[model samples]
Target: MAVRMEELRDHEAVRAVNRAAFGGGHGETVAELVAALRRDDPGALSLVAEEDGEVVGHIMFSRTLLDAPRELVPVQTLSPLGILPQWQGRGLGTALIRAGLDEMGERGVPLVFLEGDPRYYSRSGFEPAAGLGFRKPSLRIPDAAFQVFRLPAYETWMTGTLVYSDTFWRYDCVGLR
Candidate 1:
């Protein structure tokens, strides 16, 4: 499988992947969130995994603010990582994240945040954010699910509450609730 940046032609395929990965019809929220992020935040980094010309997985990282007491800092937030059901057991989701993180590090992003299952995300170097002195935007998000990955550019003073963009709140996708 080849991982590459998302393009205009990958939108529909990306949604399909999200729906398949996050079923329960709850996937609709994630699908719509990705669209809104793309529309509202053009700089959001999005990537896709393709195999045999088929889009198998998708991931997106959007800007978030760290309301630190020392100084406000800009960071990235990963969300709605989705892989086609058939590709779920494979490493597509993790690959997309590693690729995205690599790109974020290249761009000098200091931190990345996400609310996801620790069992899976831990493999990608994510740790409990609260333990690292960070706070989640919503109490609905479980402490265990609220995670952060510090890149090479990260600084000790960057710990604080993650302020998501309006699109996240508009889509009602900020937390597990």
Candidate 2:
């Protein structure tokens, strides 16, 4: 499997993957949020996992801010990582995340935040954000699920409550209260 940055033409396919990956009742909402993020955030990154020309997974990272007492810190948030049902256990999701993080790192992004299983994300260097004085932007997200990965350029003193893009709240997606 090859992981690459999503192109303009891959929007519909990416939406389909997100919808299917989160199928029960949250599919459309998640897909809609992805679309909104793409449209609204110029710094947002969308990536797709390709296997022999078929898109098997998708992930996104959008610009966010950390509301520190003194200043706003720029960061990114990883959300809605989706892998086709059949491809779930094949490491496609991991590959997509790793590739996206590498891209963000190269772009000088200082941090990446997310709400996910610590057991899984920890493998990719994520740690509980609360331990580092990072707070969730929403009360809906429990402390345990809130995690962050500080890139090489991150400063040790950077810590505060996260502030997601308005698109996140507007779409009523995972990050909202």
Model 1, 56-151: lDDT tens per residue?
Answer: 999999998999999989999998799988888888988999999999999999999999999999999999999999999999899899999999
Q: Residue 29 in candidate 2 has what lDDT?
A: 88
What clash pairs does model 1 have? none
Cα error, candidate 2, residue 173 (Å): 1.7
| lDDT tens digits by residue: candidate 2, 1-177 | 888889988888898898899996688889999988888987789999999998889999999999877689899999989998988999998898899999999999999999998999999899999999898988888788899999988987788999988888887775434
* RMSD of each candidate relative to the true structure: 0.9, 1.3
Model 2 regions more than 4 Å off: 175-177
Q: Candidate 1 versus the native: TM-score?
A: 0.97
Residue 125, candidate 1: Cα error in Å is 0.5
Q: Judge candidate 1 at residue 83 and give its lDDT.
A: 92
Task: Give the least accurate 10-residue stretch of model 1, judged by summed lDDT.
Answer: 20-29
